[model samples]
Target: MDHSYLSSKESLDIPYITFPDLLRKWAEKNPNKTAFIFVDEEVDRYELSFGELYDKATKFAKALIGHGVRKGDVIALNGRNLPEWLIACFGIQLAGGSPLCLPYLQKKNDFVKVCSKLGRVKMLIIDPGSDGQNCQFLKEMICTDFGTNNVELPEIPDLRQVFLFNHHASLPSVNTVAELCSREWDVDLPRLDPEDLGLILLTSGTTNTPKAVPYSHHALVITAYNSIHLMKTSGKYDSLYNNRPFYWIGGFVMWEVNSGGSRVTLINAMKSSSMATAAAAVKTCEIIAREKVTVALLVPSMLDLVMKKNISLRLKTIVTGGMIVHSSLLKNIHKLCDEFICMYASTELALIACNTFTEKDITNTTKGLLSCRPLPGIEIKVTEDDGFLLPAGQRGSIQVRSTRRFNGYLNQNLPPESKETLERTGWFCPDDGGYVTEDGELVVEGRLQEIIQVFGWKKMFPFEIENVIKTKSNVSSAIVMSLKDKETGDLPPFAAIVYHPNDEESCESMQDYIRKEFNITTENRMLEYLCVPRGIVSFKQFPVLANGKPNRRAIRQIILETVDSEKYE
Candidate 1:
């Protein structure tokens, strides 16, 4: 599985220096500076100096190499946000292998699926509590036992060896990755090229099969640049707290790894009460206020909860992504924080566009507008249906090409159509329909896949409908989709909204409000009658992913199933 043809120098403008190199440089530049801070076993906050982190990572790297792990092999690290997890990541990179970061809280099935997807994984590095028996790929499980006595070790049938970090056992040869870092070896460590795959992230898919996207070291470096320069991120504050899980692209690459020098605070507990939606929001707000957090990234849903709780934080910039940020939400956020930046990015591309709201830009029509341009080395083009480039102020599909783009899917087994689509150009058509304004600003309309066609007339985008509905008072979230019409034998647009749980407004009142606000009757007569949703169900809460994006697919399924069963009854 090793491909030595991919030279480390070929991967980036700066060859020989990889992500671990950056850490080493930082350590040299600021040895005593705090590299990381975490609440230790005694519930007391502990700090790791840059020099200490470098030492630990170097040893871990040597340990990995000592264990016969070679360049280009995949190493999977499964753990919550901890010092060991961070060390393992850099250590793996330093060892000349890619680190496959898995979600700490993943179920057994998902863990197995991810392991199966990563066919070339050489080893599994896990935290103390991980039940290796449930994991299918652990031929050699190395546990960095962080501080637990009652470690009910599971019998892994395929496991050939188990190495405990803090404990000594008559197991296979164990070298604390942190220990080998200082020893000098005659063998030259494999250099990191710009194009060398550095990490593998599993993206959620429509089907049960999860697709893994491998990112190069250059891709990560570009991600850091984009986060700092394009997003205008400032880490001058005391600490950085990211709520997103470490597994996802947004969490690991963009937020955690990119902000390398900052103190990354993570919430590891997962009980319903421990990580309650409201409590998470409040804790984040509190951290921002207490720690003087300069930059924070959260999903719109989490922002909504923070706003609802009236939790105030002294944040310089709060970047919200995962879903579109509503104008109303932005307006409310402005009252709490100084800047609210709306970012549009995906796992494939680090960051595409962003909109920042200063106190001045918060006024009048510029509220929910996306204000930034494409990142450096990125080219964006809007093309019409005929494959011709569209002029300014024209609506079309957004095609983007970037050096930071992912190499390809992990398996390299893209479907014929997908491969053809990608091969047409380096530009990725994420299926997002949008238009470039006269000022060259990209205005996202909606997903082409989610677009609705009713009879002969085309329907407005779901985002457009959702945006309008979201502006309504007490409406927390909304989704618009096309449902099959019994009479016309065609699909008609339908709206499903979730309002503030305690709101006492009647369905008729809400309907009237939507009808009046959207001018439902006058503009489009068909929509006024046909698009008016047949059913509007109210839930106390909205289903959301760990990263804060709405679980629309799950919600839609539940809605359909409930409605169908009701009809049958």
Candidate 2:
């Protein structure tokens, strides 16, 4: 078999419509049906029906138009998964503006950089800061950047309006959502085409700075429709609980407003702890149990914490992706649900492939990462760096073409590094290296840039070493990253591990075991010495992104700092 696969499955006839049109259809069909559930904690839970949601969004859109919002304008949205966030997102599209979802960045400088890069954000809608002090600080930052009339900063010249949510702060030149919603206009909402831009998403900059990726309305609708069908196969279309933030791709693409009348549950990020903490995982399980959620989409890191709780939950299906789906994670997640769906996807191409794994699938698999077949309407191929096709069982760059591919970046003049992602041909490279097995299953290795290079040309992917470390019974999670040698300028791998709580084995002993495992040399392990990590460190919790994926960049820095500090002390 060749190293390419085209989905031969027939596709459902998904509707081609704009976001506003989708909301209209669902609202008219199921007026009283609960569209979304906002779970704040154990005590507070709020639900919005289809009719109420549609009416609120329509009013918000009219208010936006009264504020001089025109078609094709770009608006920046900064908030968590609140009811206001939902209204603002859909209202912007209904008013004919694309909403650019903002990541949760604390630094003022980071926030300024994002707005400057967009070059033409017409308005900004943000949440009220933590308290009065925070609100004051944010007021100063916005006035200094956007409220100044004296200095005409070429960057963000179009940003003249600002709106704050759920606050009555008397900040200079700042508008509140209440002020906007109170105003109504007799003007009709603009009719938009299906190909109009829907929203802009920021990529996870694990290796580099995040870029702005835009998607059209039709693309988002089709993506969600196909995904609903895929999940329906396992009888999991009733209700979903997703903790991933609205800024992330998994937040919107996985579930959208449609005629299917699917219900979604969103956790209050302000009340919840970080996903790295056991508390957050406990809260996640609690919500799934209380809300009667049939399906949940989580990252592997969050699942790792839930599995450690040893508390079985009642759910129909559990979906996970956005990290290496470790075999151990797969082996244990079954206790919490009836079935497990592992997906391989990215922000560029939503939902590449997914498979429902069971106890038997995990027991029989020999690969470190399980292989999944391509989803319907997607084409996968293994190719060399120059785009030459590779044969089956040969590792190479992985490229994909799908019907739901994203529109070009907001800044089409991409940086040199990202130029190779979209080719003159239609194929887009996700910068991953993998191959097709003889059975036509796609097995993904880690990112090609993450390969560890030691003394000369001998290099290996970090997953090779990570798989070996995970074999230990006491280890909960392991991540291997390449560290550079100062004197020889060689890159050797080092491991960062999190052990099971209350385990009798000490960190020093685990380090010694890893070192001893690498030193063992046999005919099959001759190159094992070269692949060995230079050192090992223990972590209580790994730093994670807003999307719950491990923040590899931050993790690398912490590992280096911890090792260096220990060496000096």
Candidate 3:
């Protein structure tokens, strides 16, 4: 936790460069070096070397320019993690156009609504259907309604064309990316500026409408350098295994590719499915050991699965974040690697803070409040509702200021809450509440807006009850959130718990224990009576987002339905 050993650089010290230029630098320096490793189930995989990736991306860039992709055009790239996805993404940047990364959704209305929200998408390049024939939904939409001018579909007004991967069936009015990439076009690609819009990343649409977050080439490079700096590795041979989707900031190639280090990603056989399956996790662990991956970025869920395999994994470091690092998981870190790192980051603000825990450090630290040291170039503080800066150890709203903050959202009306959060003077509120310890470690409690109002004016953070629930011997992990009472319109807390595998308790018994614990805590005045959860739901494991954070939105819906069913019974 020493700032003296951390990576630090003034804003001017970091190099600002374009993505295409960065790719070219790597290709020239390490031409034959493996840049990307794409793995499938059963250890089947392929490698994309830097030279080959650059050559393909350049050709694809020319193809894009030939297809009328001008600078600043927002082209939608929707698909699973594949070699083609990375190539097409870099090609878009090479052509001076911004690639709008979209998840591979199957429903027609869902796809159209997401595309329409961005306003006038220039083109869409998506993968084939699960059957590998074609995107049936899109084929139906374009052929039936989008004849020639696409005048019939007002939703996607500016959509000029749709292109599927070559494996799909040939259909009328649809083009194939293979044909485009194979086209020998001599069109001049536009010159790209370092500050040009590089790519567009959508906010994880778990809670609200997915907002478009645009990052410039400069921002990408700066963050990429910071990421590489964090690995604290000098050799280019150190490999990373990351299963996060390419659309996510965590899985972004900019982070690892800049280091000239190789990265391995899990490629789901079914294109539509994005979740990392248990089979995939086992395969990932096999790849990690076989390939001798030094630093791996496995989300807590994936880590738990990998660890359950009881494989001996000794690596340089294992990086995790975007979820609460449970005590059980933290305790098992020594079995995985020499150093464990948990980060605090968001789409809006890049890498905010991280804690590097050695085995000894983990043993010495308190298990309750997880703390992180702020990264270089990031200024974070906890402030009261009135904008008063709270002293160390006093919990309040967390705000951050950084030069590398994302460019504003694109083509969407800002929600009032989002508007207020960003409109603050020189600070961006990440909607998280936490405190800073006297040692300067930042402790993130939970979401600020997720505070549950139980009685007329009594409110409590979800973590307050969650922390208490996790203290039970049988509980492995617990998530507490508020649900609106249909009858009374009050927000009361509910608990979703994952019990220890060996110490599993029956639901009836666990409920009784939870109530007893709550009663004891209330009697001792450690917690208020109103803070007790109204209902308890047990889970083998909690559902998580693609980025590996607990999926509270889905959890809330599940809890609501469970409560309703119980009442009916």
Q: Name the best candidate (by TM-score).
A: 2
Poorest 10 consecutive residues by lDDT, candidate 2: 144-153
lDDT of each residue in 6-97, candidate 3, tens digit only? 12343336776787777788899988998888887556879999988888888888988877778888888877778888888988888888
Arranged by TM-score, best first:
2, 3, 1
TM-score of each: 0.79, 0.87, 0.86
Colliding pairs, model 1:
8-193, 11-193, 11-194, 11-195, 12-194, 58-181, 59-177, 59-181, 60-177
**Which digits, one per residue and each the tens of the lDDT, describe model 2 over residues 1-569?**
76555453756687777866777776897777777787765636888776777788788889889878899999888777777777888889999999988865334664567778777788878776544443554655654443331223345687877777666445555566655666677878899998998888888766666778888888787777667765663222477777677777777724546534445555446335344557777777777888888888867767766776674566888888776676667676667777888788888877788777876666776446777777778888998777788889887888888877653576546545445555455577888888888888888888977767756765577887887787787777788987676766666777888877876465567656765776654664545445666667778777775444567888888778866543321
| lDDT by residue for model 1 (133-226), tens | 3232322322423232111223322222233332233323444434455567555566677677788877655322556788877777777666
lDDT of each: 0.60, 0.71, 0.72
TM-score of model 2 vs. true structure: 0.87
Clashing pairs in model 2, backbone N/Cα/C closer than 3 A:
none
lDDT of 1: 0.60
Candidates sorted by lDDT, descending order? Answer: 3, 2, 1
